[model samples]
Target: MGVLNVTPDSFSDGGRYTDIDAAVQHGMCLFREGAHVIDVGGESTRPGAERVDAPTEIARVVPVIRSLFAEGVPVSVDTSRAAVAEAALEAGAVVINDVSGGLADPRMASVAAAAGCPWILMHWRGHSREMQKLALYSDVVAEVRDELRERADDAIAAGVDPSRIILDPGLGFAKLPEHNWALSAHLGELTGLGFPVLFAASRKTYLGRLLAGPDGTPRPVGGREAATLATSLLAVASGAWGVRVHDVSATADALAVWRATGSPKFLGTRTEDK
Candidate 1:
């Protein structure tokens, strides 16, 4: 997966692709760069970010999705609003990547169930404004695992097929840097939830901190490409079913190399050659 944030306030790459034509072209570029899925987000979910209304989000993403769908690229709408998800699906998105795990909007699960599309349920505490305060956890992994299990149950009860659900630990949503590290180190525990896991640590603050300079200044998003690729390969080796990243070509190449090593675990790894 490759991220295409169309919002002007997203933490990374904000305002870079807000233009519809540029965003669509960027999505195609990512597709050619070997992204299996193109994830388009209209709203910025960065911590403390303000919310964008449903109509605005729909307007921002629908055209991009339509263009990508027409090009035969698999697209996923990164939204928590049921209205936006429904509109994106109708506009030709094949998946719904909800960061709220259906907590922010009651209709989201119903929308996914109705569309029968793969739904990525990310572990979330609250909306952007208040989520940072809600990051307290005795055991981040255990709490996240339990919360995700509850969400999966809710999704199934709301008519979503259990098989169509994917769980994301939400590395930086409400987590401190250490919490994000812990989650990545113990991702196998989340994968044990019996659903495919989507690891989305692309250009996240945790990676920035890990690659900080000698003066302790965090690396910028563009400078953290190597760290991101390392994390992606680690996640795949640790049993992640998919990874969300910005530099999809590099990640695809790294995974290809790891797959060629012929580990008993990665026997069937494949790469997109475009």
Candidate 2:
């Protein structure tokens, strides 16, 4: 999956693609770069980021999604608003990537059910502004897995088919660096849940912090593609269904290398198709 964040504050590459034309062009680039799906998000869910109104978010994503899908690109709506997601569905998005795990809007799960497309429910404790405060956890991996399972149960109860649901561990959403590390190391537990797992650690602050300089300055967003590629490779190797990334080409290249290096079966297949 290629991340096309159309918000002005997504923590990374926010303002870069808010323009519909630019966003469309970027989406095309991602598709050309071998992204199986292009995820378009209008609202910035970065930590501490303020929420945008539904109408504004709908306006921001609908056109870009329409244009890309019209050109035959696979697109997913990255939103937590039912109204916005509804507009995106009508505009031709094929999936809904909700960071809130349907906790933000009561109508979101029903909307996803009605749309009948793949719905990505990420483990989220709260909105970006308050998420970091909720990062506390005992046994981060098990807690995240159980939390994700609960979200999945809720979605299934709301009429979303178990088959169409994908789970994301919400790395860096409300997680500290140690928690993020634990989850990455034990991703198989999440994958072991028997649902498709999506890992989206693309250019996040944690990666930047990991590669911090001697002066304690974190690496800039542009410098994290290598780490992003490494994470994607690790996730796929560990049986993740897919990875959401900003540097689509880099990841595609790494996966291609993995495929050519005799890991073809694991690097190129999804558990969902089984």
Candidate 3:
């Protein structure tokens, strides 16, 4: 998956793709660079970020999705609102990557079920503004797995096909550095939950903290590419179904190398044939 945040305030690559032309161009570039799916998010879900109205998010993503869809690119809308997901799907997105996992909007499950598209349910406790405060966890891995399972159950109960559901551990969403590390190290637990797992630790703050300077300053986002690639490769090795990343070329090259070394099969598949 390629990460394309078409918002002005996403933690990384925000304003870079807000323009419709630029966003479409970048989406095409990412698809050409070997991204199986381009995950376009209109709202900024970065920590401490404020929420945008549904219309704004729909406006930001629909044109780009439509353009990409016209060019035969696989697109997923990264949104929590039912209205936004509906518009994106109408505009031609095949997937819904909801960070809140249906927690943000009561109607999201129905929308996803109606669309019959793949829905990625990430483990989220709250919105970006207050998520950090809800990061408390004992045995983070188990808790996340259980929470994601519950979310999956809720979606399934709401008439979403189980095969259409994917799980993400929500790295850096409501998690602290240590919690992120724990989840990353133990991703298999999540993968073992009978669902495809999406590992999306691309240029997040925890990676910056991991590669911090001697003076205690976190590494900048631009410098965390190496760390991000390492995490992604490890996640693949640990049986992740897919990885959401910013640098598609590097990740594609690395996965090629991994495949050369006898690539292992991923855990699960989406309902639609790939």
Candidate 4:
């Protein structure tokens, strides 16, 4: 998966692809780079970010999704609002990557059920503005697992098929750096929820902190590609069904290497052909 944030306030690469033409071109580039799916977001869900109205989000994502769908690329709308999801689906998006786990909007599950599309229900406590304050967890893994299970049940009850559902642990949403690391370390626990697990830790703050410098300053988003690739491979090894990423070519190459080596040990070494 390749991330396409159409919003101007996303933590990484926000304003870089807001225009429909530029966003479509970038989506094509990602497809050429080996991304199987393009996840498009109209709103910035970075911690403490303000929420954009449904119309604005629809305006941001629908045209780009329509253009990509016309070109035959599978697109997933990264929205928690039912209205945005409906409009994106109407515009030809095939999947809903809801970061709120259907909690933010009352009609999200029903809209997904009606569309009969694959829905990624991520573990989330609140919107970007209030999510960080809701990160308190006694056992992060256990809590995440239980919450996702309940979310799946809720979606099923709301008419979404169990097989069409995917689970995301909401790596950066509402999670502290430690919680994100813990989820990464124990990803198998979340994947055990019987749905395809989507690990989306691309250029997240946790990776930056993991690769911090001697002065303890976290690395910038562009500088975290190496660490992001490492974590992506790790997620795959841990039984993740899919990895949401920005640098899809590097990840695709890594996966090819892993398969060629018959899943050899991951020792943090470059496996690319020289």
- The top-ranked prediction according to TM-score is 3
Those runs of model 1 whose alpha carbons end farther than 4 Å from true positions after fitting are: 264-274
**Candidate scoring better on TM-score of 1 and 3:** 3
Pairs of residues at least 3 apart in sequence or in different chains that clash in candidate 2: 48-128
Q: Model 1: which residue pairs collide?
A: none
User: Ten consecutive residues with minimal summed lDDT in candidate 2?
Assistant: 261-270
Candidate 1: how large is its RMSD? 4.4
What value does the lDDT take at residue 112 in candidate 4? 92
Question: For model 1, how does the per-residue alpha-carbon lDDT over 112-184 read when each residue is reduced to its tens digit?
Answer: 9999999999999999999889989999999999999999999999999999999999988889998998998
Q: Candidate 4 on 1-274: residue-level lDDT in tens?
A: 9989898999999899998899999999999899999999999999889888989999999999999999999999999999999999999999999999999898999999999999999999998888889999999999999999999999999999899999999998889999999999999898887889999999999889988999999999999988888888888888899999999899999889877866545545566832
Give all candidates' CA lDDT scores: 0.92, 0.92, 0.94, 0.92
* Residue 48 alpha-carbon offset, candidate 2, angstroms: 0.7
**TM-scores, each model vs. reference:** 0.95, 0.95, 0.96, 0.95
In the range 1-274, model 3's lDDT, one tens digit per residue, is: 9999899998988799999999999999999999999999999999999999989999999999999999999999999999999999999999999999999999999999999999999999999999999999988999999999999999999999999999999999889999999998898899999999999999999999889999989999999999999999889989899999999999999999889755364324333645
Top model number, lDDT: 3
- TM for candidate 2 is 0.95
Question: Sorted by lDDT, highest first, which candidate order results?
Answer: 3, 1, 2, 4
